[model samples]
Target: MQRKITPYLLVLPLTLFLGIFTYFPILSSLDLSFREWDFMSSDKPFVGLENYALLLSSRDFWNSLNVTAIFALVSVPLRLCLALMISSYLVREGIVSRLLRGALFLPSVTSAVSIAVVFSWVFSTDYGLVNGILAAVGLPRVSWMQDPQLALGVLIAVNTWKQLGYDVVIYIAALQAVPRELYDAAAVDGGRRWHVFRRVTFPLVMPTTYFLLIVSVIEAFQVFTIVDVMTRGGPAGATDVLVNMLFRIGFSLFDVGTGSALAVLLFIFLIVLALVKAHVLGRRVHYEA
Candidate 1:
């Protein structure tokens, strides 16, 4: 009895915290999805599946979902590949490498809103550093965040720049943990760089890659701050992701029921995504390294 009580006590703080913050909110949101409310109303009435039906039929919700899927599919592979290549080079430990790692990770620790605000100016058509370089090379200045065709791409670039540091840092740790003996054995058999990476290094790093894939996809779907700060889901709603739409519905429009429904949908989508990724990638992950 004493041992069992002690174990429960050890986890009591975290259990209580989650109960208050996470579980309660999730249950409340699920309950709220079935009720109509303006978030300030005294008389909250049950609306059944009316909110879900409206969201499913709404063009804005579908558009936001489409944009979010595109963002995740494009950005996840680009980030993973880029981080892998960079980590391959930075795996060797040295003073310079350590300093570079810290410098790279600075963006991850920095505020997301701050990064968006700074990049907003950097990608400005006039007096922007990016356009300034293009002009120096005798090219026309281009509007990055204003055009619908280009705004999503610019947001992806900024997100990638802000997030790449974390991926690189994680990859470096994973790469370093890979057994050196395996590489030596491959070299002894005359394995080329590309071949060795394909067979050994990459296989060993698949677990990390898979983890990052799931996280990055979820992040992409839930992206809001940068979109809000820079585009406000505008330039014709080209950059409007799911979280942006949710915020607009819940906070801006004060439609709590519809917003909760949207949130529930987002949660279900992420759950399905994680299941699919686990089913596809779990078998390929080599834990022996």
Candidate 2:
């Protein structure tokens, strides 16, 4: 009895913390999704799915969902592929590899807001570094964040650059865990480099790939800070992601109920995505590596 009680006591703080901060907010959001209440209002009226109905029927909601889906679909694969390729080169233990790894990973640990702010300057049209270089080469200055056509793409590029380092680090760990015997066997069979990687390295790294796929997709969907800091989802609502839409609806417009409904929908979408990924890719993840 004493040992059991001790274990529970040790976990009580964390349990309470999660309950108060995470679980309670989730429950409140779910409840609020069905009710109409501005943040300052004391009288909360139950609207009974009206919020969800409005959210689902709104063009803004569909636009946000489409934008988020495009971001996730494009950025996740690019990040994973680029990370895997870069990590393959940086896997060896050497002074140069160590320095490169550290440099690559620095962005991951840096503040997302800070990164966005810096990138805003970097991509600015008039006095930006990129524009300066273009001018130096006698090229045109491109409006990266202002143009509706290019804003989302700029967001994707910034996000990929910021996230690539973390993915590379994870891939490096996964690559290092792979048994050398398999590569040796492939080499003994006189397999070409690409063939060896295709048959041996990739198959073994499927578990890590699957893990990163889920996480990166979720992160991409929930991305808000960069869009907020840089574009504010501007230039004809081009970069308005689901999370940014949620923020605008909930906090900016004071439409708490609708925002909560959007949040719930986003949550459900993410859950469904995870389930689909598990069903499709889970079986292919070989843990034996």
Candidate 3:
């Protein structure tokens, strides 16, 4: 009895913090989703799914959802693939590899706002670094953040660049943990380089890949800071992601109820996504490494 009590006591603080900061906001949002109240309003009135209905019917909501889906679908795979490739080469022990790893990881630890601001200038139209280079090469300047077609792609690139380092670090650890005996056996079996990688290295790294996949998907969906800082949902809502829309509705517009509804919907969508990924990919993950 004392042992069980002691374990529970050890986790009590964490449990309390989770309940207060995470669960409480979630429950409050759920309740708010069914009500209508601006931040300044004194009397909150229950609306019985009206906010959800409004969001479902709104063009902006659908557009935001589409943008967010595209962002996640494109960025997650790109980030993972690049990270895997980079980590494979960087797994060797040396001063250069260590230096490269630290340089790559610098962005992961940097503030998102700082990254966004720097990128905003880098991709700026009139006096941006990119345009300056293009002009120097006798090419026309291009608007990276203002064009509807290009804005979301810019956001995706920025997100992938920022997240690639963390993924590489994780994959490097996973790659290094793989048994060298497997490689020796493959070489003895006359396996080609690609064949060995396809059979042994790739399969062995599936667990790490799957973990990164889930996390990257979640991060993609919840992306807001970069979009907010760089484009603010863009010149015509081209880069308006779900979370950005939620922020606009909830905080900027002060439509607390509507914002809560969007928040709940986003939460539900992510939950469903996680469940689907678990169902589809969970079995393929090899934990033997």
**In model 2, how large is the Cα lDDT of residue 195?**
98
TM-score of each: 0.98, 0.98, 0.97
The alpha-carbon lDDT assigned to residue 242 of candidate 2 equals 95
Q: Residue 176 deviation, candidate 3, in Å? A: 0.6
Model 1 stretches astray by more than 4 angstroms: none
What is candidate 1's lDDT per residue for 227-251, written digit by digit as tens? Answer: 9999999889899999999999999
Model 2 per-residue lDDT tens digits across residues 1-289: 9987999999999999999999999999999999998889899999999999898899989999998999999999999999999999999999999999999999999999999999999999999999999999999999988999999999999999999999999999999998899889989999999998899999988999999999999999999999999999888889899999999999999999999999999999999999999999988888982
TM-score winner between 2 and 3, please give it.
2
lDDT tens string, model 3, 41-117? 79999999999999999999999999999999999999999999999899999999999999999999999999999
> Which prediction has more favorable TM-score, 1 or 2?
2
Model 2, position 86: C-alpha lDDT score? 99
Alpha carbon lDDT of each predicted model = 0.93, 0.94, 0.95
Query: lDDT: which is higher, 1 or 2?
Result: 2
Task: Compare the candidates by TM-score and give the number of the best one.
Answer: 2
Candidate 2 structure lDDT: 0.94
The runs of at least 3 residues in candidate 2 whose Cα sits more than 4 Å from the true structure, single-residue gaps closed, are none
